[model samples]
Target: MTTVRLPLFPLNSVLFPGLVLPLNVFEERYRAMMRELLKTPEGEPRRFAVVAIRDGHEVASTAPGMPDPTAVPELGPTAGFGADPARAFHGVGCVADAATIRERSGGAFEVLATGTRRVRLLSVDATGPFLTAELELLPEEPGDGSGALSEGVLRAFRQYQKRLAGARERTLSPGTDLPDEPSVVSYLVAAAMMLDIPTKQRLLQAPDTASRLRDELRLLRSETAIIRHLPSLPAAELTRGPTSMN
Candidate 1:
């Protein structure tokens, strides 16, 4: 039963555990978050929750303590996107570990945060200098499954990667094989694919690692079929072998 109250960063991108992304913190609210987090001792957790936007964009605006007279975000689920905070954001999100927070010469901040784990937003409030939320840890249930299914998923993913590389005439997928952990592997694949917003969100909110893998496998096969039969691509554009559409 671990619960935390921390600042939130609502972006248009999804974060997955074991994967990291670079962020440019220019908003006054987030800049303040960086400053406060830096004050913590060396061993404390320096993190914030990242919720992907459902139907909005990230824009610079005013927050508490800032002298700027810009728009103040509403206090609710859509709160992060100037949304209601209660209805604007998804229920599940990822906690980003601020591995590095550097002050920029432009009065903003540059942060590198890696997704640490999944969390469910229980509530949010505007009672502080920044948007704060109470989130509880969401853990994946242990699944009993055979290795063969895992292997099949991997095979389909590799085939999909090869076809994509062929079309680009260059490699885009991972250079090395994914790890044995199903969750990690699924995220890695999702990151590489140019999936739509809804599909990516579904992957992020999957109940368990096995479920994530199965969904990824289906996507991989579907994509492979699309590329394999598209007559526009030159036969030489394939990386390894063309997948059979039938």
Candidate 2:
């Protein structure tokens, strides 16, 4: 297994491969991370690892009245690991490539990135200005019957979109066509569904394409049924798709 060290950006939400991730980099630690990434020569992939914070862990706010930014918890899972940065986050994460990094006023950054691949977090270093982690790039495996699973998932996904749109009184994507490739379908469905952080994280950590698709299939059916029975859902519950990170 190959291991490489890269900057880490912990978030409250899960990131799936191929999904778009936009970030507002205002925290000093993250701003420092952006500066370090900017030093990479143009044309090279400027990448970082994005790990989801475990439930009960919060990303510190930089608002004037909030807790001091320096007093924030280290970028790692806090529930079981305590102060161990390496064990602070879930084991699996997605590596993101920063396609655009724009500097805003006050040295902050507006970054537009895309999740490129899954990785296994090996260890985290918190002694730097920003968190950096040693990661093992995880290969995408097309497990047995993935092709067949893809078709079923696609059908369920369409139904899910329809049900969700009905709940929201609008088309979710109107005419957007979903991809047929198993891994693409899996990631697309995982990113599109209105699921909790733990559910999405599980999807991201699935052993293979077929496994992820299978879980998504079950979730879609359950969600579609719930939506069907409910007369209406709140606007927030109906919201789905890629979300921005701050």
Candidate 3:
């Protein structure tokens, strides 16, 4: 297999292809990295790899060098998020392309990236300002009937949408047309529904669509069942649209 080296983004959330993620670039190194990446070929992979930071926020100071800082916690049945040798989660990831950029009030940069394909993490050479690593491209699986969710999941999804619609003060429910397959349904559901960062990252790290859907289905079921007792809506509700959310 061909090997590729890419700049690293160790985030609290997982990214998937055909998905959009927003990144806040405030660190000097990552801001510099962004400037450099902006100069690269656009139509090419425009590739970058992401790993979860186990115990630190900034990689320059906190992330340890050799043993890969213990292992990132796995949210699925397997250690999906912590698989990448260069990172916490290795096998699954989105090869994203920079889509848009905006400057925030505090001089931080906000960027939108659309995930293009999945890549496998092989090794890392953490000798630079940001993390860099060798990556193995993973073959895309033709999602057939893998982890299909039950009708209860669907019903919960609908209520989740309604709750989100009410929170955003917008009647929009684009995700209401979610496909039957577990993968598509899960991503769409997670994208539209309000969930915690760690939970969402877990969904991102799920090995297959079926697993992702199952995890999301569980979360939705729990949330729907406890909606009445929730103290407040998800703090993420303030910004909850595709372009606006992340």
> Model 2: runs farther than 4 Å from truth?
61-82, 167-176, 231-245
Q: Write candidate 3's Cα lDDT for 65-149 as tens digits.
A: 2212222222211112233334354344556677766667775577888776567677765455555667776654424444446
lDDT string for model 1 (1-246, tens) is 899987887666677787776777665676777898899799987989987656644332323223323433333223335545545567788998988999989868878878888898888776666777899999975354624546667778777766765655444345554676666766777666657767888988888877777888889999988977654443244322111100
Residue 140 of model 1: what lDDT? 71
The lDDT of each candidate is 0.69, 0.80, 0.57
- The best-first sequence of candidates by TM-score reads 2, 1, 3
User: Mind sharing the TM-score for model 1?
Assistant: 0.79
Window of ten residues with lowest summed lDDT in model 2: 72-81
In model 2, residue pairs whose N, Cα or C atoms come closer than 3 Å (at least 3 residues apart or on different chains), thus clashing, are: 76-88, 77-88, 77-89
Decreasing lDDT order of the candidates: 2, 1, 3
Instruction: Show the lowest summed lDDT stretch of 10 residues, model 3.
Output: 71-80
- lDDT measured at residue 27 in model 3 versus the true structure, 0 to 100: 57
Q: In model 2, what is the error at residue 240, expressed in angstroms?
A: 5.1
